[model samples]
Target: MADPAGLPPRLRPSTVPPPAAVTRALHAINTCTSAAALAPLRVHILREPALLRSTAVISAFFLACGRLRSLDPALVLFASLPRPHVFVFNSLLRSLPQAPACSPLPLLRHFLGLGARPNRYTFPLMLTSLSSLRELNVAHSQVAKSGFARDLHVRNALLARYAACDPDLGHAEQLFDEMPRPDVVSWTTVITAYRNHGHSFLALATFRRMFAASVAPNRVTMVSALGACAAHGAVDTGIWIHQYVQKLGWELDVVLGTALVDMYGKCGHVAEGVRVFSKMTERNVFTWNSIIGAFALVQDGEMALRWFFRMKADGIRPDAVTLICVLYACVHAGLVDIGRKIFNLIVQGEYGFQPGIKHFGCMVDLLSRSGHLNDAFRVVEAMPSQPNAVIWGLLLRGCKDHGDSVLSEHVTMQLLELEPENASHYVTLANLYAETGRWLEAHEVLKWMKEKGLAKDAGWSLRMLEDRSSKCISDGNFMECAL
Candidate 1:
């Protein structure tokens, strides 16, 4: 017979270890801290074919593999078993979601073929592994056929899968409507789906319907609702939700509190956001980011920096989001020195973070705005990734604003090369020339714009009518009125 690892009989371990030795090896596998520690135990289990038959030993091995996120080994061990109990299959199913390379559908089909009846836990784990709507529908059909359709947890997982995976929420809504009696999870799932898919208005509307149904909102529901409010800038509705939360006597837990802070901050109620942040006893990195972002949005760079320093003092390390907000503050405050220092810190990997493209963009914007055009261009050239349109646009705008006509012309040509069909770039270059009293160059640009079939927007003059209404007059009407 082939070994458990699929090695040929000749290549397999010559001697099966004793039962006591197998027991000790199993114990070590279960207690091991890291994935590396599980290696020898795996070898021991595979060598002694008798150990593979013990459900207990196999279950422990699968559990250890699940912890290590080593799905291939788990699948191999599962194939070795002639008949795996449902419990062992469930452990394998749960771990499949974390493995991007492995698909759960085939394993599930194989399990069903083995005449192993799936329990309640089976469907959810299987559903998570599926990435497409077609896959979800296939799983849904199976759930219905297997008489597990009415299982609440299984149905909820189905709802979540549709909500999260379906681009249009059509499947999710249909599944929700079919439910005889939908629970809070059902409502929350749909609301979150809408919110996540940029249908914040629909999310708020659903939350209202959920309230009308007399279903009390939980922390998760409130968080989703608040997130929708923030997206739509519905400060009034957000305030009402906050009051409702207070009425429920629920402690402002970190998740809920962070949501509230983000909602208030985004709604332009920075003061209220600060109040909520100050009173919160428990705060996470998200909370700090929200408050700092609020200050950055309002251009309160000083306060943003102050909170950033305070966050560091409190032993909470700043993440990418936090650094982005800090950089925004530095840009608005024109603290180029501080911005440079922060950029250097990120480059040095002081906080164990690799700066993404957004960070690089912020640095470019900072340098360009400070009139360090050459430095900004150098930074762009040195980037590991190609400079995007936005970075080039920033440099062009900076040149135009700072009256560096020589560099402005050069940057404009670069922008034109990147976006040849964009009429706005021609307009910008012409405007820059006009501002610098180069009327001939400006006229040439307008001529080029006309030749390219890009029509300039007609100028209009606002006129107050006798009835107190306003009329926008075109160039011809304005000239006639002047005559």
Candidate 2:
């Protein structure tokens, strides 16, 4: 008989220990720095009946196996047992997620085959593996059938899983509603779900409900609430959260501080964002990104550039997002020489990596908007990846704005090839022809569009004075636009 593919002829399948013995078992496992060192310990632990029986001991064993990329040994020990402990099964289920492609379903089947039952704690770990809405539905049913549906921890896991995998929050909300006494984790899960799924108002509403229920918001809960406030431009709500944080005497950590700064930045309160940044005792790359992005939002490129340097001076390495934000700052402020300097650093891999498409896009925007159309054209041509329609479209619009009819026609041809079905590109080219007094070319372009049954979206976007959002007729929805 051939050995199982992954099992080296023999295999057994497999947190913190509460007991001193369990703790010692974990320590024994942890002390092994390498697989060779772990091998002796693995042999001892697998043979120790007492260690295999303890929940934490076995869980740590699997974690050790996972850490060493040696789950096969854990599997061998697990399979060798005629009737493994429930904790042993649960441990394997939890740790298998680390392997990603390894599913715990086979272990589950074997456990059930041994006539062993999974408890409430077991289902939560199992649900972590669910990757699709269908899988979530199936797990929820299993949770119900196994009589663990009412278990709060299990239900919270299910709620999180649903939020992650489901298209909408309807199912997650149902789970939240059915919870008898939802705790901070429960409320936070739902609040975050609402915020993530573009229901900022509902997220805020859920936050309010969580507040009214007398469940004190944790740092995590407050962060999600602030995110909702940011999305909807509810600066007032953000202010309230800021004040509440102050009242609570909670010092601003990197994550909480970043979220607060980002909320203020997105809401157009640059000074407040700066004040928050100054108050932060420690700032990571993300925190710096937020404050710099705040400056970018307000088109204060010089200030953005100042902070960008300050971040590096403070020993924080700027990430790709930070560079993107700073580049956009240059684009908005039309700081051509400054933008070019930064783009050069990107091209030379000064930041430890070559420029990606987004960096190139920002550089192109900076050059084009600064009326350096030919230079922008060269950058696009030199891009490692194929230029998408958006890149071409930006250059085309730049050509029109600068009255470069010749370059505009060339850019439009690229756009036409890239997005053949897009009628707006056709219309733009026709409009450009007419603008340049090429009436015959304009008429011919329009005629070709007509022959292709293509029509430009009438009233592409209706700009409203009271609302910056344009009610786009093309998509039948309002999208934010500033002119």
Candidate 3:
């Protein structure tokens, strides 16, 4: 009879452990594609005491477990073996990360308990399993003590943990500076660290240094560089990067392609973004979102809607983010009817997404921009979560534009109540009153502002916020921030 691993009864481990039979069984174990395929193999390994002695056999089984994320069987196998080799322990350690729920700490302790010394490769693998700051520091100290701190693989892993995961870039930057020779991964990680931590210019500077040092940036590195360019509206830099990538003949895969699309869109070069999108041979949901976002930036609602349908046609299910892009596109083109329908898709569970704050904000902006003041206000009230100041503020802008003075006063009072100390809300209230020819009330609000030491900063409370936050498609109009 054949086992779940498709190991025939003939290939099953025998007590004698024939060399040819064992080799065939080992091949089957190595090629295991699923947990069901590995389960019976585990039973055979446990039954045949002779097979348990071969570290090669044990390591292959553990690797299969890692591949299938079946760590429990590997743990059982590890427990059965006496005096397991360091390679066997390392194999289990390598698999530890693949099993999402398993923690590596206990296994590391086991490795230490068995007096098994971890090699240079072991430190890198071990470092990836550490999450907390204290755990990371302790692991690094152990690496230094073990004399593998100078190892490039160990160094890159530590650098990545600090740069990519942790917010503390001080040590990450320090690690990069101290590295005797930082490779592309090292450079890419440092660049990513700076870009992610709000240091856009610093990230680009690191990229330039990486470029000058002749360490060629890979696709991941380019993604970080493009992101920095997008944040600072450095389209010229982004264009140069795109040309450089083209010159290098690198494939515009989904990730790199999405970064380029977002960059060009944020810089108000949607045409360039569309061209990049058309050139790409492969795309994912993120790629679709970026292209749609580019159209949203240009206020090209029709194009955005067309790409939205095409994304569905391509069989990529729309995520919550995709909905946000399309909804914002509706806001840009004042397509209230279309925006309402798209928002309904979420409420109807068509996309299986509960609308989030960002989604509600987009809808509010759409209704507000289209002069559906009451509907926008109703959405704010009906949303699951409490309406944030942005929604109230968006509605207030609509009221002001449509000259609904009564609605404006109501919104203004709500804003004042929510943000009692915000000078802009006070300024808005005063401006509304003055514009209504109610000089007394305007002066009274301004007087009250002075009493509270709230200086009425003109045109900044909301406008400056929109400037920094809504770097949405060219002209930096108010829209949600890009990915």
Candidate that would win on TM-score? 2
- Which candidate, 2 or 3, would have the higher TM-score against the true structure? 2
Model-by-model lDDT, in order? 0.82, 0.81, 0.82
lDDT for each residue of candidate 3 in 303-419, tens digit (9 for 90 to 100) = 999999999998999999899999989988888888999998898899987899999999988888788899988998889988879889889888988889888999989988898
Q: List ranges where model 1 is wrong by over 4 Å.
A: 1-25, 31-53, 420-423, 426-483
lDDT by residue for model 2 (241-276), tens: 999999999999999999999999999998999899
Measured against the true structure, the TM-scores of the candidates, in listed sequence, are: 0.80, 0.82, 0.74
Candidate 2: give the clashing pairs: 11-76, 12-74, 12-75, 12-76, 12-77, 12-78, 13-75, 13-78, 13-79
Q: Could you give candidate 1's per-residue lDDT for residues 1-483 as a string of tens digits?
A: 888998777764648655785687677877877877666676677787778767668778878887787766777777767778888888777666543586777887888888888899999988888888887888999998889999989999999999988899999999998988888999999999999999999999999999998888889999999999999999999999999988878899899999999999999899999999988999999999999999988888889999999999999999999999999888888888988899889989987897777788888889999999888888778788877788888887787668787888877878888888877777777656555545555556666666777634412210111011111122223323323
Weakest ten-residue segment in model 1 by summed lDDT? 461-470
What's the TM for model 1? 0.80
> What local lDDT does model 3 show for residue 152?
93
How large is the C-alpha RMSD of every model relative to the true structure? 10.0, 11.2, 10.9
Global fold similarity of model 2 (TM-score): 0.82
